[model samples]
Target: MSEVKLVAIFAENKTGQLAAITQALAQAGVNIRWVAIASSEAFGVVKVLVNEPDPACEVLRAKGFMFSLLEVLAIAVEDQPGGLDAVVKTLARNKINLRNASGFVAHGRAVLLIEVESAAKARRILAKKQLHILTQEEVMEF
Candidate 1:
């Protein structure tokens, strides 16, 4: 099991904000694997999983956007009913708090990137349940 650092960038709620950020990544040669965005009238937060989180953070920071880095678990689970529920239930049983989660399916498998209370513990828990936790290189391959 391995953990990857996710970069969440907060930008003003206006046109061209997301484009500028993405352009920066593109110019820097960073490959984005997964992304999610949430917003309100005031601002927006973009959560991104990329090949180079540190460099991504630097690029965004250099552009004057507010951002933070977080450690998240990227687990590959069976793509079937109850797969997500089983993982959630297991975390609940262990009193692990999940701050956020996002995922997508590829080749009949579900890859979930979750922000939990403890990365190590979460990895151990998932491993005990026979789940494949992805490393940075593995995630990039997806």
Candidate 2:
């Protein structure tokens, strides 16, 4: 499991916007690990987990893109039935709210990146349940 920093950029919902942003990151030599985009009628928010978030932020800021930095949880769970269900159910039982979640399976492990209201509480809950929680250094090493 690994914990990575994500730089979420907000931009206008217009043509060439996403391309320009991606180009900036590419030119800066930043590698994107995972990404998600949500759009409204007027604007869009692009959430990107990258190897170099600080530099990526500088790139986007120079391009005049509004952005934010968020610390999130990246956990590796068993790639089997009930893997996600177990975590979700546990959080639900503890009344922990999940803001956003995304994941994929690779090499028989389900890697989940989630944003919750409280990282400490979430980590505590997961630890109490004996689940593995990723650290920032671990994520960067990957």
Candidate 3:
């Protein structure tokens, strides 16, 4: 149940925004492990998990980008039908509210990134049910 940090950027939904942000990080030698972008007609939020959070943040700040660090949970789920559904239902039944979620498949397993109201509580609840919660090191290795 270690802490995982996600770098969230608030930017306008226009050309070059994402590129600029990513380019700055890249130039600083920050390796991005995962990224999710959600946008509306006017603005967007770019969330990323990088190898070096501090360096990435510094690069973003030096580049004049508005962003924040978000603590999130990375859970390991089975790569099959009903795997994600079961986890969501368990959290809902336990009174855990899911704020944001994104996932990806790697090495034949599904990694679910969830933003919850109480990450520690959610982690305990999930663990009690035998769900595998990935550690920060495990996530970074991906």
TM-score winner among the candidates? Answer: 3
lDDT of model 1 at residue 115?
92
What are the per-residue Cα lDDT tens digits for candidate 2 across 1-142? 3446678888898999999889999999998877899899999899998887778988888878889888888877888888888888888999999999999666567778889999889989988887877776666544
- Name the TM-score of candidate 1: 0.89
lDDT of 1 by residue, 27-110 (tens): 888889888998998898998889988788788888788899888898887899988988899899999999888889987878
Residue 5 local lDDT, model 2: 69
Give me the overall lDDT of model 1.
0.86
Task: Give the Å shift of residue 63 in candidate 2.
Answer: 2.1
Between candidates 1 and 3, the one scoring higher on TM-score is 3
lDDT of 3: 0.90
Q: Measure candidate 3: CA RMSD.
A: 1.5
Per-model TM against the reference: 0.89, 0.91, 0.91
